[model samples]
Target: MGVKVTGTVAAGWETVRAEFEAVVAAQPHSPEAQLAVRHHGRTVVDLWAGEDTDGETLSGVFSITKGAAHLVVALLVQDGVLEPDRPVVSYWPEFTGHGKERLTVRDLLAHRSGLINTPEGFTIEELADDAFIAARLASAEPYWEPGTAYGYHAFVIGALTGEVVRRATGRSIREIYEERVRAPYGLDLYMGLPSEAQERWKPVLEALPTPAQLEIQAAAGPMPELLPVAFNWHTDPPMDLVAYANHPLVKAQGPASAGGVGTAAGIAGMYAAAIGEVDGRPALLKPETVAEFAKLHTPGLDRVVSEPDHFGLGFERQPAVGPEAFGHCGAAGANGFADPVTGIAYGYTRRRFGFPGGPAPENLPLTAAVLKVARASS
Candidate 1:
């Protein structure tokens, strides 16, 4: 039977729905997923597909959590509580040495710190706790000279940045996010998934390779060095990502890097709140703050993830999508961002893992469709 996609699209956006259905049909495995878009602080697109999926269904949004984490950082910078040009060590004293004392907060947020992974890889147990992750990283050395080059910090950027947040304020990123962003804005995203909200979560399904795909993967041979480090590669016993989030410990601690659980509406709504007013509140960041954080911090070859495009501050900038579009794509084909030009906040999430991960290939058409509609509506 074909997958049933259910949801509502605002008037004049029926094409976006067709495009979303096209996206569902394009997936060979008929992945369970959710998508949402908010334009000018109003939700215009909300949809989902596959069994056990609904508008409120939550999933592990992989790295899209970075967008939430960094949004807090941007707020701090905006409030004068944190200075971008100052040394990271100023806030956290132990993050110095190994030629890293000179590294500024701007450089760290821009991914130029060269502190990608812990000297010793973090066990899933250790990885779940932001405090432990940050403490270990405090003494870790950088793979390259700080500020000279940029690479995706991947698994540990949140802890690195989160520790700075904790030092500057006696609160965790989750706490600040809840009080300032999630709670007030009524977003469905969670840095820490609460016990009461567990029922709403949709378990993420792994993308098992077909026989032919497995053959191709085996033939490809050795995985990239940084790739394994970033993902915390382990095969003596394969660790299940879904189980990790389902575990009571991880949900309680909510590791800032990738432990976020959220729905498409939550992610999109958060971004909408960032760029525009919603529910009678003001936009979170001023135009100057947005422009500053969105500035291209890394514009060339990325040494870590080996991607050509890196980020500005904590956001990955996609000029092709929009000059003002800034967000991050997660490991499980989830993506969220806000574009100032079109006043669009977008999010797409899937429980089933997508091939060659990182934003998945589906965002191109979905975003293009949304952009077309947004431009027309304006």
Candidate 2:
């Protein structure tokens, strides 16, 4: 292969390395991908295969940003800095204006707040600033009545939750992230990119679907029509996900919802730190905190994603077949989650957008491969 697979896997995980190579080899164009898995607090797999990319290249990890942002919430919850069941207006008084005063912090976390989008769709400039997003959304009535339904907040959940963090702690989530999680652990994931790390950023490539691809996607189950509304696509001009992420300003501001930039190792290491000891540090979340955060919060239909799955306090209970994993998947095929049972913290990144969006189809085999190795090792 022209683009070589580089990085190390622990001795017992050679098959994972082989699978990584096969994934890269099967791609028609240059596939830029990074995969990392930390097993039992040790990074047993670190590999990257693609052109113009090495292990350090940071990719825009769309909604996976939610996992990173919410981990901060989990930390504060562990510390009793905020209460999940408290009415959000208790933390930020302005939350009262839109009939949202009665909604609990847990309601927002479970995607039941109903403030999915606004009448005036956000420009990329507006989405770049979490405060502006929170402000605009603060007074907008929920698309559905609060607590009646759960939907993926999609573009604005983090901003919604981050605003609560700001009110409770008097610091933006980004700042708290720097002091508590990112800086302490030296994570390459950046909610806000500093000057020094700009050179390592890789702009994501948008993939246009072919007719065959479109047909296959339609066959898989029609893409949710309401997704546009959740993403603020009803206005005259709509958001282009690739353009939103690639814009220089967007990366700089690092909006809490979707502006996160990271490497696979960075994402993998983050989940590992949250649930398992890393380096010399203990896990950030206590066992009780983990249990509370991972418990099924959305058990009904997810109106935004149009799937019936469980959402747990902002983290996602991925699917039925995989190991009981919890974390967020992003728009451009980035998937990162912690399998608490297997002690596997996994992250995968791709610079190209996939047709069906969210996590790529390849993730199934990749996850299976990782879980198989992890279980065997355990």
Candidate 3:
């Protein structure tokens, strides 16, 4: 039997529903997933599939938590509480030496710090606590000269930037996000999934790769030296990302780097709130601030991932969405972002890891369909 996709689409967006259904049908396995879109601060599409899943069901959103983490940073910068140009050591004293005294806050935000991980990797428990990660990273040496190369700080950027937030303010990034953003907007997304909300959360399913995909993986052979380090593979048990997110500690702490859980509406609502008026409130970010945070700061080959990637102030530029779009995608297929050009906020989550990871390929056509309707409606 086919999994039933159930949800509603606003008038003039029926094509989106059709497209979403087609996408689900094309999946190799049933994807227990949810998708949401908000245009001009109003929800236009909300859909989900698979057993026991709905528009409000929650799942691990992995690295999309970075978007929430950086949103708080952008707010502090907008308020003049944090200066992007200042050296990171200016804010966190211990984050100095080892030739890193000159690394600016912008450098950290742009993934140019070269401080991917400590010589010894973090245990799952240690990785769940940003404070623990930050403390260790304080004295850790950069794999490359600070600000000289770019690599995804994979598991530590949140702790790195979160530490700066703590020093500049007297609070954690989670606290700031809870008070200034999530609470006021009542967004379904959470930096820390509370105990009471546990019932709504679901575990992510592992990717069931096809025979051809297995052949491709077998051909690739041995992992690169940097890939394992970037992903903290030195731990005794290493780190199983799927298991890590499902762990209770991660749900409770919701480490800003990866431990976020929420519905598609929750994340899409966040982007909507950031870029447009929502529920009688003004946009969370000013147009100029959004532009600055979304603007590309690092371009060209990423040393760790070895791909041509772009990053802004802690935000990943979604070139596939639009020139100025900004957001982050999780190791699972989840993603959330705002496209200023179309005044669209989008979020997608799946309870299964998509093949090959990092922003599921389906997002391309899904986004195109939304844009098509958005332009027609406008």
TM-score of each: 0.95, 0.96, 0.97
Q: Which stretches of candidate 3 lie over 4 Å from their true place?
A: 219-224
* Total clashes in model 3, counting residue pairs 3 or more apart in sequence or in different chains: 0
lDDT string for model 1 (23-136, tens) is: 899788867888899999998999999877898987788788889999999999999888999999999999977878999999989888877875467677887888888888
Best by lDDT: 3
Candidate 2: the clashing residue pairs are none
**lDDT against the true structure, each candidate:** 0.85, 0.86, 0.89
lDDT-superior candidate, 1 or 2: 2
> In candidate 2, what are the lDDT values of residues 133-230, reduced to their tens digit?
89988878788888888998888998999999999999988888888889888988889788899889989997856688878777787557668888
- Rank by lDDT (best first): 3, 2, 1
Which candidate gets the maximum TM-score versus the true structure? 3
Weakest lDDT window of 10 consecutive positions for candidate 2 = 317-326
lDDT tens digits, residue span 1-378, model 3: 778889999999899899889998988788898989999999999999887788878888999999999999999999999999999999999987778899999999999988899877888888899999999889888899999889888888999999999999989999999998998988888988987788888888888888887898789887656877988877677788888888888888989999889889999999999999999999999999999999988888788777676788899989887768999999888888999889999999988888767788788888899989887777
Give candidate 3's TM-score. Answer: 0.97
